[model samples]
Target: MLVYVLAIDIGASSGRHILGTVENGHLALEEIYRFPNGAAMQNGMLCWDREALEGHILAGMKKCKELGKIPASVAVDTWGVDTVLVDHQGTPIFPMAAYRDRRTEQVTDKIDQRRLYALTGIAHQPFNTVYQLMATPADVLERTHRCLFAPDYFHYFLSGVMANEYTIASTSALLCAGKNAWSKEVLCMAGIPEHLFPEKCNMPGHILGDLKKEIADKVGFNCQVILPASHDTGSAYMAVPARDENAVYLSSGTWSLLGIETDTPVTDEAARAYGFTNEGAYGGKVRLLRNIMGLWMLQCVRHELDDRYSFAQMAKMAAESCYPHTVDVGSNRFLAPASMTEEVKAALREENKPLPKGEHDLFRCITQSLAVCYAQAIRDLEKLTKKTFTSLNIVGGGSNNAVLNQWTAKATGLPVYAGPAEGTALGNCIAQLIALGEIPDLPTARQMIRKDFDIQEYLP
Candidate 1:
């Protein structure tokens, strides 16, 4: 028998409700609803329209009704950190701050970067929920019973339950690396209210509650609400369909999450110093990886230029351009810039290189530079893990840019397997499979993935 699940996966730019159905041991996904998401100014503060997002979630749940019968489970996963402050009534206390917002300024410097890394075993990302929460007003901090991540907040809405799942919580600085509870050391040092976060729970996949009677009647789904990996990357990591131990996974999209699977946490000094994070995996494994700024550079530039050209057109333009890579793109300045095209050129002019002649040249530069950065990160991973990776699985919307994938393979000298772009959703269904016992664990889920899906392999 097959079961259906709805995966609500959120990114910085957008959120989607994807329907996943598993039948006769094969899993498939369909995007049922999607909504635009981004940061906005609220009373002089950059805040996420979290209310609008929850509206999207409810709207999506309604969409599931159009398909007849409710799904067996509904799960959500989102980008790391940046949570909402909810009162005991489960209402948001304040506007959820955008992760990119400068609100963390008050807490950023106070944090001893090395000590923070040592304690949490998480890479130092500027937008971590802990730092952002620490920067919140003191008054709201006093009234909060439990802070919930974007996903958990929605789960609470749908299931009328409250709990923090492992993967998303790992992104917060509060979780102790090897322990399940909030770390007093981190809370004390960061001056965070311990009660701000929900009590940590065991793992993600389980029944949260029956769909509320109103939602159940409206959606016609009386099924249990299961928490599939509540972190999209954790869900996406579930789709790394590598057959051998020598393979590495790249959950490539807005962020290029490149890493190898491990049975245990890689908590060495080098791993910490290099900014590698030990995120949770589906089957009691650690996803030892680094988050590289991915196609966001290109997307921001395209948005800045008023979305004048399709990304596919840009990829074609990149492939047509003739250039040996010209500038150092790994600098932090390239991460977030007002104008990516201008930044690329300015970085080139600084190195005394010829300015890229036109759009094709500019496109080629970012694609190639991104490929080089991927190669560099892969090299760093190889150095840290002392394991040679044989293939790279490129998933998500970024996989459509074939030019970059070819360059990535060329630069890294590894075969690239691209597609199954709906990685997060696929991973979400796999987790349901785990919960239902159709799949024993992550590796077996990945084996089933290899059996069911078609992946395009690019050779160097």
Candidate 2:
């Protein structure tokens, strides 16, 4: 009998439920369900619709029942830093703010960046969970009973067990990067109570429990609710089919997280200066990455156009244009802009640079600028880590853009391997397979991915 597993991978813009099983010495994946997701304004703030997402999760599981592929285990992995605050009775408080909300604009200013970096080794981002908690109203914190990262909250809802996963918790800047545990000093700095978090964090592949009786009955089956990295990037990193030890990883999607995994956190001043963050990887490792503004710009521009053009069309248009201008795609001005196209135009105008003449030119500028950003990040990463990366592995949904992959190769002067488009989902499944004893360890899983997936290469 085939042992099936479900990997629910959620990002800022979408989510998918993928069923995976090992068949004839290879992994096979079938997407059971997919759903659109995004933040919406709630009480004057951008917030996730928790109830709607919960409903979608249940609906996806029901799809599995219909297909007669009731998974032996199920796990969820989502974008990190945004968390849910629960009341004493395990009910989530209303209005779980998104990481993009402007409320954290001044929250980081209250703490010393260098000092905090020393404590956590995380980059100073205005939208980090530490800043978000600090910006939260004290009245709300008073009534809160526990703080669970988004994936943890969803896991709790499924298993009726409240717990924190290390990878997701590492994004909060409340965990000591070197120690891989909660930091009382950082929590005190944010004025967040210690009681809000769990004393011990569960690692990836940990089986929380069987799905709650109510959830099992609703979905028409019971399965183990396992933890799979919890943070989407953590899972994405695991799917990188690197040929050697020196390859840099780029988990390209809404955000371009470019970095290499290290056994110890890099917290020196040079690292802090270059804006590298040390998020947790599986097995107590650290992923020292830089979060760059990524396809979100193109995604916004496409949305504004009512999505008339598919991503492929946009890429083709971009490749046809020889736009000479490249804007600083990493600028905060591009973050949550009123109009992405207009914002790019304004940025060019401010720099006395030629503005993009039309849609093709604009699209080319975005892709070229992103390539430039990726190149700079690689340079900085090499400098910080003191190791020259021979290749770049670009994964996740964004890996499908051949134009961007080729340009990334040219910009960074490194061979770019882009494919296995459902990287996050693949990595999510890897954790489940490992826990189920179908795979022995991470290296073995990575080798399996390399053998089974089509990883396209773009040479510089």
TM-score for each candidate, following the candidate numbering: 0.95, 0.99
- What lDDT would candidate 1 get against the real structure? 0.79
Q: How accurate locally, in lDDT, is each candidate?
A: 0.79, 0.93
What's the count of clashing pairs in each model shown? 1, 0
Error of 1 at 207 (Å): 1.8
- The CA-based lDDT of model 2 is what? 0.93
Model 1 residue 299 CA deviation in Å? 0.7
lDDT of 2 by residue, 16-50 (tens): 99999898779889998999999999889999989
Q: Which stretches of candidate 1 lie over 4 Å from their true place?
A: 217-220, 326-331
| lDDT of candidate 1 over 180-259, digit per residue (tens) | 66778889888888777646655867778887787677666666777777778888878878767887788877788888
